[model samples]
Target: MAFSQQLPQGVTDLYADDYELKQALTGQLQHVISSYGYQPIQTPTFEYYDLFMNVPGTMNSDQMIKLIDRDGKVLVLRPDATVPIARMVAQSQSEVETYNKFLYVTNIFRMESGESDRSSRSFSQVGVEWFDDAHPLNDIEMIVMAIESLKQSGLKNIQLELGQAGFFQSLLQEAGLTIEQQLVVQQKVDEKNEYELSRLLTQYQVNDQIKNQLIQLPSLFGSPNYVITEAEKIAVNRGMKQSLKRLVELVNQLEQLGYAHYISIDLGLVNHLNYYSGTMFQGYIEGYGKPIIQGGRYDQLTKYFDLETSAIGFGIYLDDLISIVKKQQSFKTNQLETVDVVTEEKDFVKAMEFAQELRGKGVVVNMHYENDSTTGDPVIYLSEKKVEIKGETFTFTTVEDFLTKAGFKNGNN
Candidate 1:
């Protein structure tokens, strides 16, 4: 098979309007996250494969794209930003601080299952990680930012489904399920397969009361007020009770902040990443199949690197997000109009000077010789004796007259 004209599966090139739209989306996200005091940071594009292997539940090894270094060490394209960021924070600080916040815009590489052409193996992500903050306010702040991010992206009809990992982890502990059994239950619950979940619980001969609550887990989703009330009734132990309390507080605060309409509860919401230790949530917009925004508390992630502080953050799948933005026609790209300067060879020097002047005033300028076809808006035809703009011809004089006639007064477009 010839490969000259083909790109590898699951990768793509962004050009023209698509590329500009992506840039616009990225800039909006950066502005929104930065306003929350998150300074930008970056990690290497590749890291030692062991960095992920050492942290169980970080990512499936099969999904990571790997290569061998010259010295025979194995490396992988950065599959996740959170893991590498956590590693960096752990290695840099002698002692964990009370608060640390950072943001990043980078690409992650991973292999997708199923049809390769239908899925992306590489894509950009915009996200932030907050370290050493476990207060419910921290979780609330993350959720609020996630909501604001989608809203700022020009997405309407957004929903943020909130959950707590501890809610179900506690239920599993109370059921006394082994590691293997717990994984199976989590998968079923995440799938919302009540029948399979019930059959599995019955097969394990779980206590009737606990089994019933386990079956109820998948259905424990809806308005926070209703879900919290129902979840309290099924609270089997203190762990389950505490998880509900924390979620209530978060929802209440969000409600107070006027974001109640965007909040929903999903007790069965399970993140693929194992680092999450507490509050977890995902943001979605109408018509998208997957969550555009995902985040949660992972107080245990840094401990693997010997830094015991708490951490929580979220990542927005930028490629998928831009697609949604394009479909909704919600985000309008501020396409800059270019001014083309067409001139004869003899007038080239003067045309160049005029082009530079327009550029200095923040206008986009493209220089063109007389015969060259022009594509930009507001074409300017300059010659020794005449200046023509928009079909209005003026006898060539001082640059100021042309500037004023072009509607660029005092450098303000």
Candidate 2:
């Protein structure tokens, strides 16, 4: 039994010019990540289920798209990229004194509710992972590289919202709520429902000061100085103060780095990705309601692999970003390199020779065996005693004459 002429829910195909545009954008992403000295890596689309099973702060069990291996092992379509990269780095024998930088342009799969129209089952991600580097400067570089990568996509009017997930985690620790209570408060805060947060705090018996801090967390966003000043006043523990100080220094250095204009601080901009152990950031451009870019530091995650690595990274959601690139700029995706070489049946030899020469010269040559309908592309037609280019026909002569009149002064040479 088959559904007639329909794709699986939330899965659609891409072809022709759309695929080309995606490839071009992917090249740009790879080039930018490479320019920053990050090596490119490709991981399998699926991995063993155990990779994520013990990893706290990652996806829940139900979220994974599960499969059964031949050996009866449970496998999953990769729900995230960073964890796989961590596993790779952990198993490597390469001796590195300081750090490792890797970037991957890959697809991730997660089960989605196509019925509710919340998301798609598949997505393209361009991301980087810097391993074993805890210096705050490394964090800043990750942010700057994210900005530059978006810029490479020809996107403008970009804004990146910065936050400290560690600060929020520290606050939760200071509150000392039970896991059930914490989960309730986290859900309320994650939804940005201050009213609900208020209600939850009211029901829970915590210190009033901690309750007030959590309630006000939603409003704690502004320019750097203002945000830091306000955060410093209420940050309860040493971790909270340290988180604030790090953010302040990050802003100051970014100012000196001359990227202050594109930066904004949002103390309330907590990401739901619980892996983020420190600074977290999200990027947005005009015409898109959701952030197209997101990444953060997750120092605790690598410990599950027992590698003792501390790192930070981010990924540009290249799937949704293509729409933004198209909407923000005027561009051409139909760049053709091959000129169709049409020939009369008898002149096939000549056409083949010309195509061979063109190929030797690193030019793409499309043989037009029988044209149906293709317009606005370069074509070279050969027949009994004539060759044609453009709309004007030319005498049967050397490829040099064709090159000369085609405005290639040194084309023949």
Candidate 3:
């Protein structure tokens, strides 16, 4: 309760520039997600704890922020969005029986140290879910949108790493490992711990061929064509062959769509087999400590809900993108030529009208009854006959002159 007390770790507070940057980017993300024809949907900030508890592919309870409701039912602040969306579709009783495409930009919560810190503990996640359509194009479109959205956000030097969970799944099925043993190897591989994988393969007496391929999997990444060629050599079973073929098809489609330059195959990925039923990928930008975006196909996730729907989706970590955008374009993120209008007591009426007019012309206007920016924000003060921007004041006898100089224009010139 003391002012000097600091907030929790992995959580953060956001102010003017930080907060505004996040909002504006969230809007941009919505535009990109919508353009793919994925209609928008929303889920609760918290839900019955059972919704995600022990969910095979979801994060563990230790990472989730949990509590009790008045009814005594356990509740969890939603840690992730994809699983919730899948649950929503399964529960929908729509009689039409048609395909569904959904998208949303919402806050995701996790336990952290701060009550006021809104950045790390609470994240703005924007993503899309295309259900009932299992075509490779659905997968391709999401990847393409990911690239465009990042580029649109002024982030350059992005690299997309692609892989197939099916390949690994096939390897496990052929290896005849129990669920417990399979999980052990999958975790080690997902973390790229080759030593543990080697140890497990020898301890479990895994076939020489399966062991060799599992060992080589993490290192098999490069040009799409090359990786597929390498995977083909080790793909001994029908499932492995099918997965290899699927990856080839995805690469061909990317090339046709002209996104091949951003494509590289990473055979090492071992996302929970329960999710990521097929192609999975992660996008990275320079300077970000983690992936800016990550998602994959989870066609079988619906099975848990008694629905056979096929789906693939991805989520954007808008917080990370904001950091990248801030460093890359601080001036732009500061908002478009901010104009704060202040008027004398008698001109409040005209000032309000002028503020609305500025907004109509696509400029951000801050209207204040007084002449000061309380938060130290750079302001443009508009008095009865003059406009003060920064420290320089300019006289304007006409509204048209004020509009033109402040970078606003009336329609029709």
Candidate 4:
């Protein structure tokens, strides 16, 4: 019952030097993550179905690639990294008091494709999580870290769209509309459809405060000063006021970081993930219509795992980012020179000694074994107690000499 068929739609191959680009991008991502004091973490590719599905605002379970485990428990390939990071932090409840900064570079599986025509299945992600650091300053740090990482990746023409979950939550409460009406309003805001938002609020018989707040949500995007001015006028829940004040502080701190020109506040931005109890931000790079980096605060995650702690984090879709990086002309690395070590079995020990010497010096050495030796070049050398040097004008002398030349001053000396 085997048949030759296409790749089940939305999957393709990456070949040749393109693979190298992926590695380069990953290296840059790790460098940025490390610079921010975040340590690397590796989590399983598959987990119990409940890990993702239990979180509200996360994607639907149907979007996951799933199968049954030996115990008949449904296991699923992770559709996203945030939930798994949350699960990890939750599992380590004792570390709640200490600040936890973790970063991960991984592959993620998604059931749906974007608006682009290219077929994609599994993609890579680099994300960071901060646990027990619930200060507004931490939120700003996360944003700055994301921006800096994208910049370090050689990406340009980036923009940040910021939003506060508290603002939306407050507007909903102040409207006093039933849950159903609130959902409708939220839907309209999410789509940035102002007319629909107004209609829903009006239909729910909401007062002017609610109607005005609903209308403002669609228009509440601009510089920090501009947003603060307008946020004062929106008469809603107290949390919304506190949220605006915090956002103002965040913007000021970003200014002090010399990245003020890169920041903008967009109240209309919705889709706050379950873990983001406060601020949420997304990063967009040139030529890529989708956000390359995203993260926010989640103060309630530890409670889910039966612990009490607050945490926030973000993940960059590394695969999508590589595509963006490939389009750039500057990220290309120079080709490495290929070296061949030529020596026969009669000189095998000599060749090996020389090769080892070169290796100790940090040079990438390719030995020409006797089985595959050619009559091209014959090079000879001398061996000391521990020092084996081949010929003059050779790439390496004794292993010790090679090590010194390659920047290894002391090797178990």
Candidate 5:
């Protein structure tokens, strides 16, 4: 096997228009996030292995790419931004204010065991974390921002399905299921496999009342009004009731904001990350089967770092986003036009001067000696007294006259 010619599985190289379009999408999302007061921040590409290993629910250890440092400390490529950002916030708790907001566009590396071609071991994520604010309004703000960010990326027909992790967790506790049993049930519910979920609940010999509710979990999704009303009827315990109340508040507020049309409910929409302690949501664009955005409230994650702060955040799968945007042709790349300048050896210095001037005026200029093949829009033939553009030749007395004759208005074509 030739290592040089082959990229590792689940990785890819991006170039040309694809890369430019990805950048354009990222910029649009960043602008949206920043507009909401999220200041950009970055974490190292790798961190000590224990940083993640110690934090259960962050990610599976086996999925992490690891290495050993000189002193024999284990390190893993950063698999998640939220966890590390939480760690950073905790470490700087004394220095910074109690509340903070951060945004990031970073790469995440992890091993995907068995995934489709759409899955990449390395991918970029655009996300934001709001710290120390657990009010329902904060949750509303995050969801609103998520919708706006997706719209900014030129995605229409977007649907954000909201769920409550606490609601599901409360039901699990009432069912008295062991950790292993809980995982099996959670997977079935997350998949919306009601048949399997019913079989599992019956096998566990869960209480008749609780088992009935568990069986209906998969079907507990639709419009916010319908799901919420139905979920209230099954509210089995205090925790479940409280979680539902939070959902109600969020839905009411979102409706007032005129975003109810974009909102849906999914009581069974459980996130694989165990850190989520409250509302969990995912955004899907029409025609795309997988979610482009996912997030939730994980008020307890910072406690693992010895800080008691509430937080919520989401990551937009940039690779997936780029694919959808390209398919829709919704986003236009702000690619600059390149102009090629052709000149003789004796006039090279003059050509260089003219090229710099054009560049200063916001045009992309490429220099070429007359015989050199050029690859740019609008080739310019520069000599002592004549100028040529688009097969039309003319004589100009000054650079300003040349600019006017070439039809460069306001420093650009």
Candidate 6:
């Protein structure tokens, strides 16, 4: 492809050795997932629209990259991987145990053609989903694994912010607001506009106690203990208690993980994903300025695929991870040597043999005979009688002497 056909904007070609960086992050994330017994999984980059649309916060048809199949049915590039993965787990699994854990890394496409403030329209997300597990311990484990994954990825100065979706949802349920009013409150929460939430709650007619509680929800963020202390003071109706208890148990387990220092609770965080029916959380690194990882318990998510189970999990935003690693002072980009072996057809057999020999010893070798010696900053010139490697030239009376000089002891020798 010519440079004229290069990507328009917000997209970059990885000309540098980004593979090493990606491999480091992938290996660490997979290590944590494996230690936690979560299996790796993959799904198609495009799927039937019906799969994701069942869940809210999924982009509309216009926002997705929609295409028509030969049969005239609509197909979409997967905006997110979790939904397709959930569909797969539900339809593919026949186990009676009713518990499943999965981890995946995939690209998510979005319509950001006109957006400013953001550079890329297409981004990558890494996340995990668990099906049919409702225990509070399940939520805590997910958060801990997120912390572990980041730390294992060589990141520090990270914070884990926990939020209970049910907390705010229960409050809204009791607020007696019309669906429209509830939407107003939700919009405020999504925007993190606390002043509007307060003004609206005060003006609206509702139970004063509930109004005050709802108003306070937006400001309810602090250490887990502090947030829980405030949360317990709220009227503990049956619905409220269920959500509160889950939060408490999750915090207790998180404390046990010795990660309580990195943990905070934000009662205001309402994830866009509605299927996250229970505890929802996000991971943040200092310089990333956005959630580097996001996952939560989505109990109702599997039901869309005809499986009924309580589940929760998270996705690691790999692009976000790379961004953070880029900012972090400790993370270093590795430099690797590039070798291009030039040989004529007469020397091709010997070149092949030498290349295989270098490969077996774990050297990164590139065999190309046409490289302009003047252009390569470092060059290697090889011949049967002499070898010039990295500006040093050595002549040998024969190939046997050359091999001996290079310390290549032939197995057949």
> Which candidate should be chosen as best, given TM-score against the real structure?
5
In model 3, what are the clashing residue pairs, if there are any? Answer: 8-113, 8-114, 12-117
Sorting all predicted structures by lDDT, with the top scorer first, yields: 5, 1, 2, 3, 6, 4
Q: Write the per-residue lDDT of candidate 1 for residues 253-365, one digit (tens) a residue.
A: 99999999998999999776778889999988888888888999999888899987888999999988888988899998766546677788787788788878777766777
Superposed model 1: Cα runs more than 4 Å off: 1-3, 95-99, 115-118, 203-205, 372-376, 384-399, 408-413
Clash number for every model?
0, 0, 3, 2, 0, 9
Ranking by TM-score, best first?
5, 1, 2, 3, 6, 4
- Taking all chains together, the TM-score of candidate 5 against the true structure is 0.93
TM-score of each: 0.92, 0.90, 0.86, 0.78, 0.93, 0.84
lDDT of 6 by residue, 98-141 (tens): 44777787888766656322356577676777775486666677
Regions of candidate 6 where Cα sits further than 4 Å from its true position = 1-10, 56-58, 96-99, 112-119, 199-208, 329-346, 367-379, 384-413
Candidate 6: lDDT over CA atoms? 0.73
Candidate 1, residue 242: how far the Cα is off, in Å:
0.4
Q: Model 3, 1-413: lDDT tens per residue? A: 65766877666788976888888888777877778777888988888777786468576676688889888988888888988887888789382155488888888987644432233777878888888568887888878988888877778788888989889998888778988898888888877788889999999999998898898887888888788878888998999899888888888988998988888988887765357889898888766667788888998888877777788888888887887888777325424545667777688788787878667766667777776766443354556466665567677765567767645544222
All models: lDDT?
A: 0.85, 0.80, 0.78, 0.72, 0.86, 0.73
Measured with C-alpha atoms, the lDDT of residue 122 in candidate 4 is 75
How well is each residue in 246-289 modelled by candidate 2, as lDDT tens digits?
89889989999998988888877776557788989999887688
Q: Kindly list the per-residue Cα lDDT of model 5 for residues 1-413, writing each as its tens digit.
A: 64578888889999988998988888899999999888988899999999998987678888889999999999999888899899888888984364498999999998867753335789999999989558888899999999999988888899999999999999889899888898889889988888888988999999999999988888999998899889989998999999999999899999999998999999999877889999899999899998999998999898899987899999999999998988898888776656677788888788888888878877788777764645636667776456556667777776677677777764643
Worst 10 residues of 1 by lDDT: 370-379
**What is the Å distance of residue 97 in model 2 from its true position?**
4.0
TM-score of 1: 0.92
Q: List the pairs of residues colliding in candidate 6.
A: 126-315, 126-316, 127-315, 127-316, 128-314, 132-310, 133-310, 295-314, 297-312
